[model samples]
Target: MAFEYAPAPESRSVVDIRESYGLFIDGEFADGAGGRIKTVNPATEEVLSEVVEADAADVDRAVAAARRAYDRVWGPMPGRERAKYLYRIARIVQERARELAVLESIDNGKPIRESRDVDVPLVAAHFFYYAGWADKLGYAGFGPDPKPVGVAGQVIPWNFPLLMLAWKIAPALACGNTVVLKPAETTPLTALAFAEICQQAELPAGVVNIVTGAGETGRLLVEHPGVDKVAFTGSTEVGKQIARSVAGTRKRVTLELGGKAANIVFDDAPIDQAVEGIVNGIFFNQGHVCCAGSRLLVQESIADDLLAALKRRMSLLRVGDPLDKNTDVGAINSAAQLERVRQLSELGTSEGAERWSAPCELPERGFWFAPTIFTGVSQAHRIAREEIFGPVLSVLTFRTPAEAVEKANNTPYGLSAGIWTEKGSRILAIADKLRAGVVWANTFNKFDPASPFGGYKESGYGREGGRHGLEAYLAK
Candidate 1:
């Protein structure tokens, strides 16, 4: 007889969600000139809170505040002093990790285990990592006197909300620049909680400012004349718009955009391990990852066996409440995202691909998607070429390593890819030939604070997460 598991839902009482949230400008919560946006929980479709939608005027105010902070406080502050503030923030993140994790799971619809174990811990690690580099940047080979780029305008996506914020903000601050960031409208709660963290750290006013809103507010924030640097993480279409908007200007920009990464498995690869990596690659965070391995390329010899194993594993995935500790997949981030996933999946079937999904019951009220995969997928198919950004995998068969490389690089994106084999020489050789910014061998979606990450081609430019990341926020 199989073991039946009881409910082990994480308590929501750890977090205190506010009824309404305001913009975080100049180190305090303030009313925005624009209207309000209600953020809902994707798991239950429950209205979490209404946040002020910052406007062009709010952007102007935030930039002014950031400029003042740059000129008078943060920029002139010594590196050692800045390190102290960053370290303090890191400690505070660790102290309140549980609260932050619960809040993230509530607002973002990621599994509680992921929010607590992966997301929140990485947030603290980033602060600590950048803090160490704060006083030692001269040793980083950026020269004896690397200077700040004044005010930075950063915009983060709903996926990995706080971690994305850390990716953009940590290194910028370590280099002594002030920032004004805007979080995605649907998942602004955690960023606001981070704002309170900033206050708790007693960070100087305007050192870090968070403005909550949708696309329009982000447009205003990034295009403001006062910003010296702009960083964005979202879709490729919007990234191109920002690039065009910043053209012929003095402002520097770094875009971490969309991806349709490939996970290549050779005949000699460990079948069981590759299956697990495949699951983690596409289904982690319900496939919202920019570098998610949505394209699975399996050698023709092992393709059938791999597919069988993958299907069996997918059948075991638990798709339900975000707060459920045993859940493997959680809700889609929003209604629009859910629709996109559905439309693309429908297109996959209509385009002559065979579709299969995990047998799991999803909550009727919330935004949810079962883990799915499509076989007989061709490189010419829209599902193989475009970024689905959902828990949908498109499997393609390759006969040789060269063909695998060709098929993997066929997409316009080159953010990340994975290679699975036991041979070290093959791993090195294949990784060298791949066009992605990061390649994982025998594993996927592994990250570290010391390792730099980004993308190539339309996946966007510039690096984040390490010493290389600091250069984007520093002046030459």
Candidate 2:
């Protein structure tokens, strides 16, 4: 596949602001209280735009706007009317999907292929799916008539910038709740673009607000007393802080956090198919995926053979410009994330695991890491225990199905796990025992708008995707 740049289908020449971006509040863009921060492209180290940093005062204003919307207009609106707005938003998202995808690729450094195909399409489909549920919440298994929570404070990560926003805001709005959303500081462009979509859709004022800033801004949004609910998707550490911060408050909280998922391959599994699943599990989106199978658990009997095959497959991976459609892996999301991956890879070597990489030339201008594998890794190694959140696979072996199950559940994180087996009985048996939120028997990283997604245990709670996702925004 040759690299190709697909400009947004909408007019790209219309982007107006050259320097600073404002926070979206009360259906309009407004300046932030704190100083301005520059948004940079990790792929080329170029400054894309400057974004307003929302301080405590800005958080207060956004929360007040959200509260007013919930009380005066949004909460009193009929479910059918809310459904119409959601439908409009969905239509506008589809219309501007290409442009959002391009902006996402530039700001987040994910491959354009993923942004175009996976992220954008899913985003549109998510709003569409949830839109239908707005008027039919009675049949969604949440009792006869579930009411909307007052105001929701949502904070999404940078990895799948626009997609995460859609996941958080779509359901929240469809359920008749007003929201104050904060996109990660590094990738605020798509969320800002989404504000335009909301405006075009004629969504009611203060129904959805986008506050652009770093961690402090997120903290303010999450800890605000006026927020009726809090939803977040990011690192486990921050998730814990939010969990603690919202403790004892009436704020209904749900977190989609980190993961150290294991991709287990049985000896009876088809080798070629398993290899493909392995690559897609770990290397897809440069391994920035939350449910990415960072740990490879192979059967001891055929470990040598499988390792050789996996190495050969990895050698062919193309890593370079995210705009290139041919690229298998793109730049890391940021310099900070690159440092985190590097430090953990070094820890893997220091902890006695064997590190290996293919002979691929990386772009000198971008923050890139080759698809890497660490063999001879034990369950005790830091590489195996922690969520590296990069295109690095740590290989370990087990003898029996029991051992595989044990190894897979060894981590504190349990967002998702994978099982590659031909036997139906074995697959069901293993799936039953694994303590993961998602279990992919024959596939890896498969997501659908109708499917429910969230983590169990430390990986965080609350579903994000399916009919169950409505619970987060609904009053029980």
**Which pairs clash (backbone N, Cα, C closer than 3 Å) in model 2?**
3-324, 3-325
Tens-digit lDDT track of model 1 for 342-384: 9999999999999999998889999999999999999999999
Residue-level lDDT of model 2, residues 1-476, one tens digit each, is: 53444432323343443577899999999987788888888889999999999999999999999899999999889888998988888888888777777788888888878888999999989998998998998998888989999999999998898999989998998888999999988899999999998899888889998888899999999999999999999999999999999999898999999999999999999988999999999999999999999999999988998899899898888787777776678899889999999999999999888999977988888688889999999988999998899999999999999999999999999899999989999999999999999999889999998999988989999999899899888898
10 residues in a row with least lDDT, candidate 2:
7-16
How many steric overlaps does candidate 1 have? Answer: 0
Which candidate's TM-score is highest?
Answer: 1
Off by over 4 Å in 1: none
Per lDDT, the best of the predicted structures is 1
Q: State the local distance difference test value for candidate 2.
A: 0.90
RMSD to true structure for each model, in Å: 0.7, 2.4
lDDT of 2 at 158: 84
Supply candidate 2's per-residue lDDT for 462. Answer: 93
Please list the residue runs of candidate 2 whose C-alpha ends up more than 4 Å from where it truly belongs after superposition: 1-17
